[model samples]
Target: MDDLNLGKKLQMYRTSRSMSIRELSDATGITASMLSQIEHEQVNPSINSLNNIAKALGVPLYCFFQEEIIKEPVVRHDSRKTIGRPENAEEVYYELLTPDTNGTIEFCMMVIPPHSNSFDSVHCHTGEEVAYFLGDGDHIGITIEGRTLHLKRDDSVRIAPFSNHVWHNDTDQTARVIFAITPPSF
Candidate 1:
């Protein structure tokens, strides 16, 4: 990975969110001096530190590795960024419909396998999200703030910022959904 580019992207995201270095440090549990050094490209951040930074910035860890800003507007289907594979606790797969996390809104297509959950535990982020379920004759259950809601085909639900939520597929059929979030959180 190019340390200079990573540092620049980090600074850009942080400033876009109007977050100071100290605030980022507090959020990621990293030291302010270390964050500053990383931002300045004085030192390369470790994987753990990078993960914490990505979580604090509300962007995917891969966003830091994206080499350049997308000059083209369209993200081809074959080239769409995919994440959250078998290595993760949940086997849910996510394909980025948008080019990158540089924009105000982020869009993704999520595929949840049968009898699996979107997350291993309750997930909460700092942005408002809307999920639209797709596919015919299939459904999934979403639990938000301790209340479980069933969603069928073409159903859409809005989740408020920081509300704990999770998506679960109990049926034998795999579930697919399109998600849009402001200030992207992967």
Candidate 2:
């Protein structure tokens, strides 16, 4: 079952890059016919062949075994995957709004309950992040590098990479925010 799925994914990635089977075959040193068979799920490729293909496609070998491929660009609200809350923070929730692909940017929706914080401590990551407030009521509190900024509705803020940051919702209403991170450090 996994072999067939891998073949389909390979085909999708190759076609998405506008690369022909012959081109991939020449780049990977595999025969064109074998490449076609592998793409069609008619035959399974060895580990070495898969590694070569992955190199030619400019993707990691593990990409074939990751989550299901996104058939469309839009992510439905109910179908979004949750990244799970912090161990010490139950008042916050996170949902991944973008598909996990070979992209540098990742979108996530975060909900912070009233009068609560997202995490117990500030966290830092390698990639930059920008967060925008969604609702028209209340201001979301964001602390970055010891500076606190209160963001109003539709307001956005950028945070540098490696800066310690956390979010808080001090109002009586829930705070909703959509954040985009580059290089997907989360």
Candidate 3:
């Protein structure tokens, strides 16, 4: 994470979302002056403040720390960055396949271990998501808005925006999927 560049990235994301500083402040419950100071690199926001800002921006908290801005169009597999997850997150893992969020869509690779779930609770975000199962069989189950759908290899699903969704691997092998989200809300 580049501490000095955080403010610039914040400003970029805020402007890309068409949100004014005042609007962000109102949404995050932070003072407008403080937000301005953060954007100007005059102050360092605490983790709590950053979490609030991430929630307001509809992105993962790790998005702020990603330093690769994707100057070129290609993203190599070996160079792909992985988002940090909790230490206890042994069931699921995520690898960011997209080099940057400066585009309309973000891509990621999700791996769910056997008999494990992606999340403990169903979650929803601001943008639409499409998931493509890459496993060999219908071992992946995705629950969206209380309906569970079994997905096999080459199967894809388009999830509505803000729909509660969670995935699980019920088989004895790992389940893999390629997930894409519009507006880069991941």
Candidate 1 local lDDT, 79-120, one digit each (tens): 776654423534677778987777778898988878987776
Clash count of each predicted structure: 0, 0, 0
Whichever of 1 and 2 has more TM-score, that candidate is 1
The model with the greatest lDDT is: 1
- TM for candidate 3 is 0.65
Q: 1-186 in candidate 2: lDDT tens per residue?
A: 242277898999999999999999889899999998988877766545675787799876546645655566878877665543334243576667886544678788887778877776787767889989996457888999999999988999999988999888888887889999887754
Sorting all predicted structures by lDDT, with the top scorer first, yields 1, 3, 2
For 133-154, candidate 3 gives per-residue lDDT tens digits of 9975466899999999998889
For model 2, how many clashes?
0
Residue runs of model 1 more than 4 Å from their true location after superposition: 1-67, 86-90
| Candidate with best TM-score | 1
Please give the range of 10 consecutive residues that has the lowest summed lDDT in model 3.
82-91
List the lowest-lDDT window of 10 residues for candidate 1: 81-90
Q: How accurate is candidate 2 locally (lDDT)?
A: 0.75
Backbone clash total for model 1 is: 0
lDDT of 1: 0.80
Best of the two (2, 3) by lDDT:
3
